[model samples]
Target: MPATSALRKAKLTVTISGDVINEIDEIAKEKGNPRSQVMEEILRDWLLKSKKMAIEKDIEAYYISLTENEKKENREWSMIATESAKRTWND
Candidate 1:
């Protein structure tokens, strides 16, 4: 797919465990945000962190906390290749 075609956005519905749902509701109340707004903020944070935003300290700590399986063992290109293949093919 072209970049634009690859970037379609839509609403999604997911079923969460009761405990998780309750926690989300509690956080929404505490933050004074609707559930959808809270979800959007959380998703925005995840995207920013994934893309290695300006928060180097947080990103560094995040990298440091990775499990062995999560770290790259080879050069950057090889890691990118492996990750691309993994992302393109589930299981």
Candidate 2:
């Protein structure tokens, strides 16, 4: 869930360079909306993407933590299954 909900709005203070502010304003104009709304939507999208990336990193770390023998066994079993399947469906 997002920190800011429909019924819950929080104040935030952000400092950006003038160029960035102008870019945001330009995007807001292009989208026919206020700069604040554009910034909020962009920030929300970034937050969601950052969360997904963090989750992926954690998953990779977990995969790396598996025992070496376990990984080897899993790979060997997978290859055997692939070979068996190919043999059963010979062209």
Candidate 3:
């Protein structure tokens, strides 16, 4: 996907639960923003978190598929990196 600096606005028609609407309204009021802004912020956060979780799952699956020798090497490298970081921090 191409990155854009501008946000595109669109009109959406959907039915939402009353409880959810109330909560969204409350958040909008608290933040002094319109309901649309509140909803957009929430959806953006959800999308980012969902993407991060998917990436994490993909990494975990890849790691699980690695051979034992490769996994051992990865762990050794991680430990060495951790030790180096600790030394750098202490210094």
Candidate 4:
């Protein structure tokens, strides 16, 4: 987590499987961090990954809805961008 004084904390209570708890404890011990910190990092990563997947899905749907001409134009623009990147890197 970023060092922000504005961050708020809330207490949550939930039941988890013993096996999962054991794994989290082990990781926490190895990293010298509390179980809450480990869980927070895990949840944060999951949230980011979920957000990325949702964005990708939306982009896929957008592409699928595009007309043939729009797709061709996109392809052409992609090729131009690729060539520009290559030139920039090779220079």
Candidate 5:
């Protein structure tokens, strides 16, 4: 993770369960970082995971929308690509 100084700061408050807060604090202490820094990393990871899931969902929908003929063509192309990779690797 980048230094906190490299990023703009936004101050906000939210209520969390005591147990969760304790866990966050423990992790922060172990890492020699502040609670806010730990929280920032957690939120960043969550946002990245959400983005990846959204992209996956979009790709799934696109594949689902393809016609049978288009699907077959894609499979044929994939096989060709795989064979090409195999030949290249065997050389």
Candidate 6:
């Protein structure tokens, strides 16, 4: 499906806990928005944070998977680049 089509609003009938519904209602009242809008905003924020954490975990895994030799090489390359920069700036 097209991304836009997937993003299009659709109504869902869900059974939410009473306590959760009350919290949503409170947020709606505080923000002067409908319960659905408050829920959507909360869900969007949660999804974004989840995606960021997943990406961070993936990056950490990638670094952890590198061999010791590869890590040493990467450190050496970084040191060389730093030295080159320092020389350029001093001259």
Estimate every model's Cα lDDT from 0 to 1: 0.82, 0.91, 0.95, 0.96, 0.98, 0.96
Worst 10 residues of 3 by lDDT: 1-10
Q: Which stretches of candidate 3 lie over 4 Å from their true place?
A: 1-6, 87-91
Q: Which stretches of candidate 1 lie over 4 Å from their true place?
A: 1-9, 53-91
Per-prediction TM-score to the true structure, in the order listed: 0.44, 0.68, 0.81, 0.81, 0.86, 0.75
Local accuracy of candidate 2 as per-residue lDDT tens digits, 1-91 = 6555665767788889999999999999999998879999999999999999999999999879989998999899999999999999996
What tens digits encode model 6's per-residue C-alpha lDDT throughout 8-90? 89997899999999999999999999999998999999999999999999999999999999999989999999999999999
What's model 2's lDDT at 88? Answer: 94
Candidate 4, residues 24-91, lDDT tens digits: the string is: 99999999999999999999999999999999999999999999999999999999999999999999
Q: Tens digit of lDDT per residue, candidate 1, span 1-91?
A: 5798657766889887999779889999999999987887888889988667657878789889977766655356687998999999986
Pairwise lDDT winner, candidates 2 and 4: 4
Full candidate order by lDDT, most accurate first = 5, 4, 6, 3, 2, 1
Candidates in descending TM-score order: 5, 3, 4, 6, 2, 1
Model 6 weakest lDDT span, ten residues long: 1-10
Give a tens-digit lDDT track for model 5, residues 1-91: 9888867698999999999999999999999999999999999999999999999999999999999999999999999999999999999
Task: State in Å the error of residue 32, model 5.
Answer: 1.8
Q: Tell me model 2's lDDT, rounded to 2 decimals.
A: 0.91
TM-score of 3: 0.81
